[model samples]
Target: MQLEPGAVVEGRITRVTDFGAFIQFDNGETGLVHISQIAHSFVRNIHDHVREGESIEVKVLGRDERGRLDLSIKELLEEPEEVPRPRAIGRQSPQFEAKLRSFMRDAKERTTSGAPVKKSTSTKRKK
Candidate 1:
């Protein structure tokens, strides 16, 4: 059977490598599942996600110039739900506004007093 892009197929992982896994379909066609395409989360080790002789469903991404099949497992799976980030405890709006107001007041005082503003020394010096 011809494998088309976007086609989902079942295959057995023949070998697992640090970079990717080799899957052989029932039709004897083989494709590679890159480490990045193995899971929704970061894959430090390919074996952590999939093992040899394991059956998996993968989507055909497309074919390379040499007509080799390029497959992805994550594409066929639902994306992981995003977790809500926790709000910073000590940085509430009122506290931040108060600090901003204080800084502005100090800056206005320095400007009104005609005190020379200090120059920043972070810029690179020209040769």
Candidate 2:
């Protein structure tokens, strides 16, 4: 009946709330599945994921400072698909090396010249 961290248990949803759902394990021990741990994706409403009296399998995320069991349904679920990252156009090693050389040449010219170099401003324009 002692629930340890990383323990997977089958429980019934005793109650549901805006923040989380209360789960009562078969051993009579209870825990809370926080809204964030309810689903793999963003959960704006806990009710959308689970309902009262529903049976679910959850993983113990360990106890809190108050010794209350914290659980997660998302951890028991399968991993989500990875999103593709966007690549910068014209971003290559040769282009990077050329840019570095250009920067060094500019810096050298500024140092050799008696004129003070102007500070560069952000390229993002304010709306």
Candidate 3:
């Protein structure tokens, strides 16, 4: 049977490589399932997902420039649900804003007056 594009069929894994796996259909037609098409997550090792002589269902993704059949296994599997990210923190509190404004005002005053910032040691208490 001719494996047309968008056709889903059963095939046997003839060989497994680092890039992808070769599948042989019942009609002797062969196709390649790339590593990215193996699963929804990253595939570090092709053997971890498929091995030689394994039977699996794949979808025909048409042919390449060289006329080689391209197949996909992940297309048949359900996509994973995306987790929503937490919302960003709200605006700063009124007290925090007040402190920030006060600090900025003091800095501007010191700069404009060309006065060096002095560290307060008057709060030091005798033991």
Candidate 4:
């Protein structure tokens, strides 16, 4: 079967890695499901979610320029239709502060690097 980019498919988990899982399509095409694409939440380990030789449904998010099929299990699974339980919204934590500081540091470095950054160039037509 010709595996088109963005096609949804079901594949067998041939191997699992700390970084991602390798899947084999029914037609014998194999691809890697990047760790980041494995789940919506942070994935501490790939094996925790999928076992080797297990068949899992996935969406072919796309292929890289080299024709590597990028798979996503979370994208193929239907999200819970039930309303989410309400939690304390906007509650700040120490982790949030740490992440904010890290982002600011990176932003500062990028600004000082003298690298050209893309910006909106479209002129808004005035009425």
Candidate 5:
């Protein structure tokens, strides 16, 4: 079967290396799941996570320029929990409509001034 980018498949471990593991895709294609991508944490060896002849499910990330496939096993194994984001820096906790009104007011003031509002000058130089 033709495999599209981001597709997932099951494959058997054909080889392992310091960098990655060679896997045989079920669709007659082969892929390498990089050691760094094997899991969320650092992996010292590919053999610790995969073994020869072991069937594993991996996500088809795509092929390299030389036609070798690149696969990912991390995303295939578990779904990460959604993170709760803290308030964005420099942004006040205000409703959307209130922020919009404030922005509009500032914009109107700048436009009606008819001149570039001077930002700053040496206080001693000012009359």
Candidate 6:
């Protein structure tokens, strides 16, 4: 089989490492699916996504300088829907707006008065 870039193929997971997983094709060709290409989301552990002897579909992401195949599992998977960011605090929360306004006012007062703002630190007592 011609393992060209952009080709999709099914293979068996021969080994899983900290950085990536090794896939062995039916033709005895082996490829490395880097941890970054394992999932669309952040992958903290490669073992959690793939294990030895497991069968998975991977996309051929071309070969490296050493002529080894670089594959990706996330490329075959659909992209996750993006979540909209929360609205600004002042627009949504009145309490936060009030606190922000109070803080701004205090900051202005301190600046105008030429006084340095003092931060309170609690002292721990030893028994």
- TM-score of each candidate? 0.63, 0.63, 0.63, 0.59, 0.58, 0.64
**Tens digit of per-residue lDDT, candidate 1, span 11-116:** 9999999999999998999999989888777777888889899999899999999999999998977886973354658756998999999999998999999889
RMSD of 2: 9.0
- Show where candidate 6 strays beyond 4 Å: 83-127
Worst 10 residues of 1 by lDDT: 83-92
Q: Which stretches of candidate 2 lie over 4 Å from their true place?
A: 83-127
Identify the superior model by TM-score, candidate 1 or candidate 6.
6
By summed lDDT, the worst window of 10 consecutive residues in model 4 runs over 79-88
Q: Report clash pairs, candidate 5.
A: none
lDDT of 5 by residue, 9-89 (tens): 778999888999888866677788999679876676677888888988888888889988888998776645653354556
Between prediction 1 and prediction 4, the one with superior lDDT is 1
Candidate 6 residue-wise lDDT at 58: 93
Q: Provide the RMSD of all predictions against the true structure, rounded to 1 decimal.
A: 8.6, 9.0, 8.4, 18.0, 10.2, 5.7
RMSD of 6: 5.7
Q: Which stretches of candidate 5 lie over 4 Å from their true place?
A: 79-127
Global lDDT of model 6: 0.91
Write one digit per residue (lDDT tens) for candidate 3, span 1-127. 7699999999999999999999999988899999989988778788899989989999999999998999999999988897335567999999999999999998899889977777767877899
Q: Of the pair 2 and 5, which is ahead by TM-score?
A: 2
How far in Å is the alpha carbon of 43 misplaced in model 3?
0.5
RMSD of 4: 18.0
lDDT of 4 by residue, 76-111 (tens): 656666634536578689999999999999999889
Best by TM-score: 6
